[model samples]
Target: MMQLDDETLNAYLDGELDPVVRADVEAALARDAEARARLEALRRVSLLGRTAVDELSRLSVDESLQERVWPLPKPEPDCPAARTGRAMTILSGALVLLLGMGLGAWLFPSSPRLAGEAAAVATAWPRQAAWFHHLAAERRTHARPLVLDVEGSEPARLQVELNRTLQQRVVVPDLSDLGLRPLGARLLVEQARPLAQIFYQDAGGNLVSLLVALDSGPDTRPRFERVDDGPATAQWRRANTRYVLVGEPERVRLQDLVPVVAERTTR
Candidate 1:
């Protein structure tokens, strides 16, 4: 077994290592309790940093900093540069948005109290969704065989298959306007909860993913947030499930699609 230092472990946790090194680190983590514990400690710190970033975003909405953190701007009727810039920004940010944690939910448990649980869910779900998205995208990009018992453009067909396997109603969003068509779904377990990852592809050939999981906590009002998971991800919660949309790195574009996705899936 290769021994990993704190710096290597931290880099592994933050997804700073290259793919080959990362795979080795993962293998090490699986066999090392001490490494896992250290990784968990690092995770707590990362979560704290995310919380601080969230709070800072809330506070800086009226300050100059807001423009830098979130540079979303509406385009004038004739100005194409704003729209082009927005697209470029989202794509560029996607590299930074990649979620660093691997098998996040499976590795990290939620807090016990409702508040703590909710906060944990809030902080973790988006990243988890992002991580799933990256996996799905890689499969698509590499032309890897996706083991789907039911695969098609029809949402109903996919839903029936999902229902049969998951024993839960899976909502399929109509994202045709966004040029994404439903391809299929696969079942997964994360943090001991059922997850339905629905795959789609746009006319432009970009892979899009919608991840649905039962709302484990109270029925809080729907909330939206942008998270970095190697790509720009838009996540929102509905009455019964959490929906995360992962696509090419365009934060503004992702945000614009969130409402359409949220409305369709819930309905």
Candidate 2:
């Protein structure tokens, strides 16, 4: 029997394993509850890490601070080589500064402000949904196989399946007016709570996802936000359900559709 080590399980989750090895891991997972639990824990940790990185990348330094930290070179006569060199220098400096800030945050997480921010992020369902959306979008872009437990195009059927699996009412909002159609959905778990991500695509091939999860938090109206440099997201809680709509930032005006989805789901 193959040992289901962390590295092997991580590789399986990332779709980096060969068919034979993946089969072996799956077999082990089927028989070993401990292995399955370990895999889920790893998945949660990976999701949280990606979310933190996405949040960190969105941090912006003040323009004055950036200028003071890496003062631009004095302008010289127009030359391709000079321009390229200057651009490279600025890019490299920016990357270094970003990396340094990330390191500082990781090392000194005990800062009151930083700790509070971290706690808020950990509890934010919208951000978690955005992170999952980013992963799915990335895989779709790269033509990788999406690991969906339930796959289909019918909204009603998908809704029924999701609700059954989650043991909770799930609303699959129709966006036909917006030229989007249902593709499928996948189930996810966060802190043992179930989540469903319903996939949709527009006529132009733009992908969107609506993530539904049971919310114990207070009911709130839809609020729009961008997930770092990734998708545009609109999140809201209605009664006991939380919904997050995520789509391509350039192609989707998530705020406009928030009302449409909210009304339909609420009804």
Candidate 3:
């Protein structure tokens, strides 16, 4: 009776769920053979990857060194010229690494061009869903205070497929922190319209697909639908943007995450 939903299951996996929910899920997994098997498989893969990384790290060190954890001894300073050059090389490498990390962090967050594209979609997000469709866009980020808040689709991952699906990359990797994974992504382009789509799912495999299509017409009609025939529900808003989420029956649960996501995204 206490089946874990996608959000809760993902939280459990990520060690973020509360004690009550965690205990409930634990009991449910104990009784649900299929769920237990899946969890075991996930854990095995995760542990195997970590073990391999540890082995590689060990291999990086010299095998003959007895004091692997600390310096055993330093050779005499007979080779001053070589030592100075080595010090300079080490310093240069460290500087380069620090610079690379900083640059990577900046570049990883919403690229500037992507921000403009997302903004166009944000304008329409408010009009898509009946719930919170009334929420207006506002300045949120430190750099772009003009960022608007709109509820449409869950922000997840973007898959850029070149040659119509031959190559791809996961654009939004941060959703892993939110107990979600990338389902799929695509860009919607038309003679008069341009839009972006990102999809996400939790551990229980419930998916939310977001469609951000540019408002081609002067006015666009936003709609919401809960499909009885399918495992998905969709909502759209027509402001200066459009957003949609499609998923299994767990979509009702996903609705609860929207306000939480909106609060964080807008803050």
Clash count per candidate:
9, 0, 9
TM per model? 0.48, 0.53, 0.30
Query: TM-score of the candidate numbered 2?
Result: 0.53
Model 1 scores a C-alpha lDDT of: 0.63
Candidate 3 TM-score, true structure as reference: 0.30
Number of the top-ranking candidate, with TM-score as the measure: 2
Please list all clashing residue pairs in model 2, or write none if there are none: none
Off by over 4 Å in 1: 1-122, 147-149, 218-229
- Clashing pairs for model 1 are 90-249, 90-250, 91-249, 97-228, 97-229, 97-230, 98-229, 98-230, 99-229
Looking at model 1, report the run of 10 residues with the lowest lDDT sum.
109-118
lDDT preference between candidates 1 and 2, better one = 2
| lDDT for model 2 | 0.73
Arranged by lDDT with the best first, the candidates are 2, 1, 3
Worst 10 residues of 3 by lDDT: 132-141
Per-residue C-alpha lDDT of model 1 across residues 219-244, encoded as one tens digit per residue: 44333443532555555556666677
- Error of model 1, residue 95, in angstroms: 30
Whole-model Cα lDDT per candidate? 0.63, 0.73, 0.44
Our tally of clashes for model 3 stands at 9
How does residue 239 of candidate 3 score in lDDT? 39
RMSD versus native structure for model 3:
25.8
